[model samples]
Target: MQTAAALRHAQRILVITGAGLSADSGLPTYRGVGGLYNGTTVDGLPIEMALSGPMLRRDPALCWKYIAELGKACLGAQPNAAHYAIAQLQRIKPDCWVLTQNVDGYHRAAGSPPERLIEIHGQLSPLFCQSCGAVDPQLSEHLQRPLPPLCKKCQGILRPPVVLFQEMLPERAMETLHEEMAKGFDAVLTIGTTASFPYIHEPVLRARVAGGFTAEINPQRTDHSAAMDVFLGCRALEVMELLISHI
Candidate 1:
């Protein structure tokens, strides 16, 4: 409730979210316990390597196997309270924008406007052809297809637009984030992320530099913990629920 005072006065806000935000929704972090990569693949490669662009290009079956599994994991996983809280904040403050590292698309599911929500890591739905760039939005349909689904347009292999470990971040998404950063914000709120990427923490650092309030909600301390104006050492869902009431 103490952080509500900062949000009440904030005109423009930026929220950065990560995998931890969706963990409560039954999705695994892919690195921690019960994660997709707690153990190596049958081929003896890390889950990160097995899901890279090169692997997708070379051995599409292997990559698609994990991709399909990820899709199944995301299926039926509803957005949690934290996601809805962010969405509610966006409605209360149209200037509030979410920059999420998650590819799960939960923010959108929670009613956040597509225009205000930036999926920095791309979403799992809308499979696209690697050859012709054709997009298939029916994830369920594609999931029912073969391991390495083919594009309807050119019969090329279809793949999700998610940013693989080896692939560069989507240019448009990064450019848009930088554009938002240039405009500046009144506050920065980070939820369930370690702030591992420079871009993830840059907004918070910039907010601090500009004298804006900055807060982080995580169960454990993160790299940005020392710099946060308010560090709520709690689960994002619980903290967000409390903060939303004050807003």
Candidate 2:
């Protein structure tokens, strides 16, 4: 296995991370055993319905509940080594563009700037009013004690800025991702999340479609793991630290 060095040294790198990246940080993602109600009581409300655009339009309180849960869960969470590795890689390769499907703000907290990071799923930092269309941003401190951020103007319901189910990925961001893949990036790294699985796996799929080498960092054997030229199976943080040392 050629260490992540070669990939990290690429002229143009496009690194896409998914939910798995945050899993090590004590965040609960689907396919994990731990979560609200031990991931069991969510029968009536699948993730999509609870976080989709239409649902937000129908009931803002649901979005509030979702964000509230996330806020609560994030209280004890900290950025793991994998996230720092991404930042380190970014510093090594300034031209690289990093994209992530996670809504959690760990990457940002880990020092990845907004300019270099593309959060495809949106974030929970801001709250928007579905009625008056008012928007406000909340730093981590605000979330500790309160309901989800509310619209100051109309007091209308407020929801987090995530790509809910039935919502399309931000068009501008997707275009940028496609352009990089089409231009034939030197290396494409998929990290920690199901970006190696069915969802958020487009970049890996693109690499395969273009005959480009692929990299995967995940603990499980995702469907496309076999296709990757390099597979680092473990916590993303550990894999990243190893890869960074080599780089």
Clashing pairs in 1: none
For each candidate in turn, give its C-alpha RMSD to the true structure in angstroms: 1.7, 3.0
Candidate 2 on 120-155: residue-level lDDT in tens?
Answer: 878766666767876767545556646545567887
> What lDDT is reached at residue 65 by model 1?
82
Residue-level lDDT tens digits of model 1 in 177-224 = 999999999999999997589887789889999999999989999989
TM-score of 2: 0.85
Please tell me which predicted candidate would have the highest TM-score against the true structure.
1
Candidate 1, which ten residues in sequence have the lowest lDDT sum? Answer: 29-38
Q: Which candidate achieves the best lDDT against the true structure?
A: 1
Tell me each candidate's TM-score. 0.95, 0.85
